[model samples]
Target: MRKTITRIMIPVVLACVFLAGCGTLAPNYTRSAPPVPVSWPEGPAYPATALPAASPVLSEMAWRDFFSDEKLKALIGLALENNRDLRVAALNIERARAQYRIQRAELFPSVGASGEGSVSRLSESLSPAGKGETIDQYGVGVGLSSYELDFFGRVRSLKGRALEEFFATEEARRSAQITLVSEVARGYLVLAADRERLALARQTLTSHQATHDLTRRRFDVGVASALEVRQAQTSVDSTRVDIARYTGLVAEDENALSFLAGTSLRAELLPDAPVNSVTLLDEIPAGVPSEVLQRRPDILAAEHRLKGANANIGAARAAFFPRIALTASAGFASDDLLDLFGSGTGTWAFAPRIDIPIFTAGSLRARLKTSKIDREISLARYEGAIQSAFREVADALAQRGTVNDQLTAQQSLVEAAADSYRLSEARFSKGIDSFLNVLDSQRSLYGAQQNLISIRLFRLNNLVTLYRVLGGGAV
Candidate 1:
């Protein structure tokens, strides 16, 4: 039985190996270049920065190195591990890999073994002997069912398509990881800004309360007017209102941060440094080539899909040819169970079936056309992804170029407001100016400080944005 099986299987294995080398009808794959300019845009918004000969590869830099704050780094780490979106992306890669394996298996035979036994009794004139007779039979065999021989590379093309799709899924996971890192950093910055605002509000409230107390003492001595004392009380009440608003804002920020962390966070992971104090990431070196966008996982994923589409076209073309399947088995069989494996009981059978497409009413042509169209669509999508990435980088550059100026001017305004507030207070004490001047200066100073925090937040966020648009070095 063993020799008989080997005799039947040798030819089948050789045929599979030989025909698999027969090239696929799918057009030779050539990577398409991005439909974008070779260099980044330059103008007032995008300042030209020269690239050094040893410019570090941005894609190779780790996120930890990009973000300087240890606390923010820790938060990003937690998010990468626990974020639901990232986890889903990872699971999708596993599923795609399984699908690829399944497709690849089609290139070989599906071998199996089986055993059978039967007992029957016959009694009738229809029987050769007009009397009753009993019969028993048993058999065992090892064989392979129908397995397609890829003479035209139909199965191979399908396997190639599955492999490319698997690669695309892996890139998708990388893209998701990049997005998660950027989001966590942005959330941390937002929380810090709110906390700083809350602190500022509290300080303002205390100062207003002290001024109100001094005005009341002056009124008790019949030296200050009732109008001035009322105005002073108004300042205190207004500051208290601001304090309440900022206190709620801080709590909301904490909730958002916790949600991003994907679990209840300890106080240590929360932002402690003010928005300006935490250096999120170093400025991305200028003159980064447009080729860098190709490294972005999203763009790479799109290109993989395009390659898969190209494979699909080959599979469709192969469908126009005949499909040959081999189903063969070799074993031993006998009328008696005891003789099932005896020397004289060897048995074998081989069947090769061919399917020819005679009249499909243009369905084959339609399928081929559809596959070609799919390839074109994938190509367009790939190009579109490149254009989108270019636009994002340009936008980031535009905002980054101007943010420092805004921040610098805001700081100067804050300093001037503080001096004016101090002078107004001295003049009010000496009766050279009314309390309204001091109140105006205090409001201006508080507003200027708030604006400064916002600008700092924008500058930090711009850095984070540039990192993300450049693929975050998360690749």
Candidate 2:
């Protein structure tokens, strides 16, 4: 009996060993290199700062380290914890992980134990004894069913594709995290800028109100014409309208920030004044464009997708080959319940199946072609992601290069405008110039100041853009 059992198991064990060494039918995979330039584009628009030999890579930095304001840092933290988009991204990762596990399980057999008992009555016409008789059978066994032998690497390729997809999802989650940080910071900056604008409008209103009062008194004393008093009133009314508009804008900014943070923000944690200062690092080195491909999560995700598509092609190719499966069981069987596990009641079965693709009406060929096309699509998307990343970094660097010069020129213009307004006010007070001159100068000064604030905001926001494009704060 032992010899008979060993002879039956030998072929099964040999088949398992042969299948274990089977090669995958999938094509070899290699990363599609980025088609962008080796170095950053150079011109007056690009930063001229010396490339430090040992400066820390920006992408590895933490968000708290990148942003200096305590309030802004806290807000970023709050958004990271409570943001709905980020929460969804995390859940997506979990789902992908589970999916990968499910696919991987196909590479192994699932063993189980089952038991059965049955009784049946036979009619006398059908029985050799020519009488109705009852028969009983009992059985129990441990075995596996329809376990595919990976002789053509079909299951392995599928598992590989699933694993790559899981990695891609992880990268997507990282990309989502980085985007959330950038948006929170940008929203906070916008709120600060609105507050600054509101304050400027209030100050202008106060100055215009005082001037209106003076012009009215002067008209009462017959020292000023109705035209001058009316112009002064015009300035006051225009400023009051601006104040009301800006007040509404500030509230809207707060609401936007609240939505991004995914939680109600405390008043004390908010910026009280326009953002005059921040803790962003002085410089972010724009390394080679190819370097960003490795750092940017979106780009990494795209590449992973391409690899998964390549693995899928292998699976599709394997479909054209024969699939082998094995099902086996060993147990005991007897007619009597008490003799189910008796020493002489042993029973066993071994079944091996092979499915050869004889005809499919071109379905197998179509599937293989589909997988190849899908791989090509993924490759195109990966290259496009790299090109898009290059453009964003270049644009941010261009803005960085010119922002300081723009800020300097704006500051000089503001100074000159303020001086011109001061002289015009003095001349108007001494009756050397018309009231219209004072009004013109006041408008010029106010316009220059507003422009200056806008330039400052642009400069700061550009830094945020650079950080985002470089994949900073994504750890």
Candidate 3:
């Protein structure tokens, strides 16, 4: 008996050793190169040394520190707490974690207990001579039913895949968080810009009203023509129309801000100041471009997805080989309930089963092929995500430089236009120029001021974009 048992166990042990040597089970997935151009266009030249030596990288700063306004920080905090989209993303992470737990459980043996009772009459034709006519059956068992030994590392690979998927979901949540922070910041900046424009419009309306009153006095004294008085009236009326339009815009922006913050608080509750009052770093410090692969949440999520896809290939390949399962049970049962636990009524069972895939009409092969194709697709998508991220960073950097230059130019134009309007007014008052010149000067000044506000807003928005593209702050 011992020799027979050793003969059987030796082959089983050798088989296990052979399967263990198969190695890794899953295909290796190397990081793919990004599809975007490695080098971006150099931003407009600026004095590199002009930036403060102590200035920190934008990504190194916490968002709360970067946005110093107490109200704005509170709003962001509320959004993070109550935003529906962020809550959904967080729920998905929980779901992924649960799935990972389920997959990991497969790597271990499962134990269970079961019991049954029945009474039956034996057929006369099947019964032996002198046998009882009726028989009672009872069973109770503790069992390990159909436990698979993962000598080929199949379960391990699957667990690895699930873990990667869990991480991927976590990264996805982080990506959503980054996007939310940027959105709130952008909206806040827009509100500030609109408020500034409204203030400017009101100021212009007051100045135009004064001019209209002066023209009316001159006309009553027979010193100005009716046409000059009419022009002044038109200017005042147009300015009033702009004020109404901007007032509506400001209300709309406040509503938007309230929605983004997940609250009913009015814009008045926010700080009433221009975004430029918050100091942004003079220069954006870019880390190594390759570091983006690790830092960017979306890119990391994509890579994890790729890893999952690769693991699936191994699981599919496993289907082509035989599956082995071991089952065992030990228990006691007796016809009399009182004797159910008696040693004489004890029972046990053991089974080792093997299922070979002899013929599947190419199904297994096709599944394996499909898995490989999916892995390829995931790899491509991962590469694409990286490329997209790189482009976003490059685009933000380029826009920042361009917008700054544009703002500077627009400021000079606004100053020049203001001076021209002053000279035109003085000339008209001295009776050296026509009212037509004054009207033209006033219109030009209004246009220049509007343009300047737009440029300032663009510059501020570019900074927001840069912060977002860099995956938000360290928080």
Instruction: Flag the better candidate by lDDT, 2 or 3.
Output: 2
Q: Residue 350 error for model 3, in Å?
A: 2.3
Off by over 4 Å in 2: 1-22, 119-135
Q: Global lDDT of each model?
A: 0.86, 0.87, 0.80
Relative to the true structure, candidate 3 reaches a TM of 0.88
User: Per-residue lDDT of 194-294 in model 1, one digit per residue for the tens?
Assistant: 88988898999889889889999999999888998999888888888888988888888888777777888899988887899987555586455465676
Highest-scoring model, TM-score: 2
> How many clashing pairs does model 1 include?
0
The sequence of per-residue lDDT tens digits that candidate 2 reaches over residues 397-418 is 8899999999999999999999
- Go through the candidates in order and give the C-alpha RMSD of each one to the true structure: 4.9, 3.9, 3.8
lDDT of 1 at 281: 55
The local distance difference test score of model 1 is 0.86
Between candidates 1 and 2, name the one with more favorable TM-score. 2
> Which ten contiguous residues of candidate 1 have the minimum total lDDT?
280-289
Q: How accurate is candidate 3 locally (lDDT)?
A: 0.80
Please list the residue runs of candidate 3 whose C-alpha ends up more than 4 Å from where it truly belongs after superposition: 1-17, 21-23, 35-40, 43-60, 117-138, 266-268
